[model samples]
Target: MLHATGSKKELTRLAYYALVSDILEHADVQALKQFRHHRYTTRFQHSLNVSYYNYLLCRFFHWDAVSAARAGLLHDLYFYETNAYDRTESPGQKSHSAHHPEVAVQNAVDRFALNPLERDMIEKHMWPVTHRMPQYKESYAITFVDKYAAIVEFFGLGAQRMLSHIRRKQTV
Candidate 1:
């Protein structure tokens, strides 16, 4: 229903603007731009992509778009260099996928007045890897969108191409 009056691109842009308009100017959120995420993408870029995708899905399903967008944007708020982790290390000093969610949740809570849904979404985006299911629909949307964004970033797709690719995948 929401997309009926506008092109997907237009709708996505609107949703993206709604997600970032207030948070973009926040110093801590802006600092995310400096951290590297998947491949060559910055943490800010990846977060934006995830938030946008989550926003689209939330709008499509008539879910909590604001909460999904906010949680998606902060899902990877952990500030350390993720690439430094050694795969061979023990559980206590391993890859980021297992630990960053908790750290990110803590950081987000410290910086933002997050609702329970947002906190759950941020803390459980890792899903089966973390063994905790999302307690809210928006949280599930964020989890899926986060994975979608990660795959896109891993493949080095540009913004326009990423949207197109995601659209194509949605159809299949």
Candidate 2:
């Protein structure tokens, strides 16, 4: 069942799906399924969690929830395996945190015509860790949502795995 962090609602059945259905259908977004995030979750799932919670938060605040959701979905949209690159502190060489957003923005722009708010949110979701401050309110919303979703995806999925293992053992 597809659900977001801290919520049990099935995402597709909810109103939130309307905002991201096209982006979700794209080949580039689907490619995230191959990348692991936070150890226990796929980048696709992590992105979905970020997207959903971001949408909810932005909607509550009366911000641009559509942009928030789209940006969240595309924020980490890079292809390389997570640990494959040797991230370095060398000047002019980008760390993984600094680099992936640019790649994601480029990839997203190629497939979707993003507004400035969406662009800012995707580019600055890493916030102070990245070079610029997020210019849009929705952008700031995503930074928190991204981190929140990661923690939940990491520990929540780990717990789920443990429960599943226990269930299997009990069945035996």
Candidate 3:
């Protein structure tokens, strides 16, 4: 069982690290650090943030934290360089937003013994963009958190940045 004590942000960080420790140790999961997600964030860092938020939400709502954490961590597991998609001769090549979810799902499935909910969370995270709605609460949680993390990463304003900002404010 995980314990939460401290500021909300600190508690969430603790829960996230506790929940995702196992997944992070997987060789396949570790490879995510090699891929860039958006702006200054690596796929591993973005996924960690998503997984952390999912875990925090699910824990608060009494949902399945395990599934949410695992699926969220694996949600962007499509290992190809995203830039490569642009090099195709034709426009029909697997575009990141339209196609990477399916690819990520397959990769997650191949390596992990995922439950249906976990699989669905990984498969349908892109939602209306991918035309697949989440079939479970955990799926929805992961989907929402994934987008939130992406926005934070895209702007290079995630927890680390927030912390830096906070410290600078305190010193002023």
Candidate 4:
């Protein structure tokens, strides 16, 4: 587990904040267009949503914020668009639900000179419940945060639909 030890916590937090700020400042407008809801959400929005949820999770766990933030930001880099995972998935691929973590790891490797910890977190983000279980604390943190974000996004959409149905019933 990447326990928050000594000054590492402060250093990592600074780095995490800086990275997130940098990413957001340089965020592509086209990428923002990709952000959408489950019913009508875009991939960019989903990534941002994951990021926000990951931030919350990091605070909860007192983790290395830099690792968690990076993992959250890049977790869905492969999706390109919303529902892309579902549209062209192979039947034999274990879980369409959890395929993005490894892809995200690859993206990180290609895009950044990540340390072993960062790479491990991205690669192992979908463990236990995934094809393979997470091996470290940072990895487990990513996995938990990813799952947490997805669940919130899922239920958030479902709740919106449920409320819409209720409103329709009242109108009828």
| TM-score per candidate | 0.78, 0.89, 0.78, 0.69
As a whole number from 0 to 100, the lDDT of residue 85 in candidate 3 is 71
RMSD of each: 7.5, 2.6, 5.3, 7.3
Worst 10 residues of 4 by lDDT: 1-10
Q: How many pairs of residues in model 1 come into backbone collision?
A: 0
RMSD of 1: 7.5
Give the poorly placed runs of model 2, Cα more than 4 Å off. 87-92, 159-172
Candidate order by decreasing lDDT: 2, 3, 1, 4
| Comparing 1 and 3 on lDDT, the stronger one | 3
Give Cα distance to truth, residue 169, candidate 3, Å.
Answer: 21
Clash-forming residue pairs, model 4: 34-42, 35-42, 35-45, 36-41, 36-42, 37-40, 37-41, 128-133
Q: Which candidate tops TM-score?
A: 2
- Report the number of the highest-lDDT candidate: 2
lDDT (C-alpha) at residue 20 in model 2: 96
Stretches off by above 4 angstroms in model 4 are 1-17, 25-37, 80-91
Cα lDDT, model 2, residue 47: 92
Better of 1 and 2 by lDDT: 2
lDDT of 3: 0.78
lDDT of 2 by residue, 13-76 (tens): 9888988999887898998999999899889989998998899899999999988888889999
lDDT of 1: 0.76
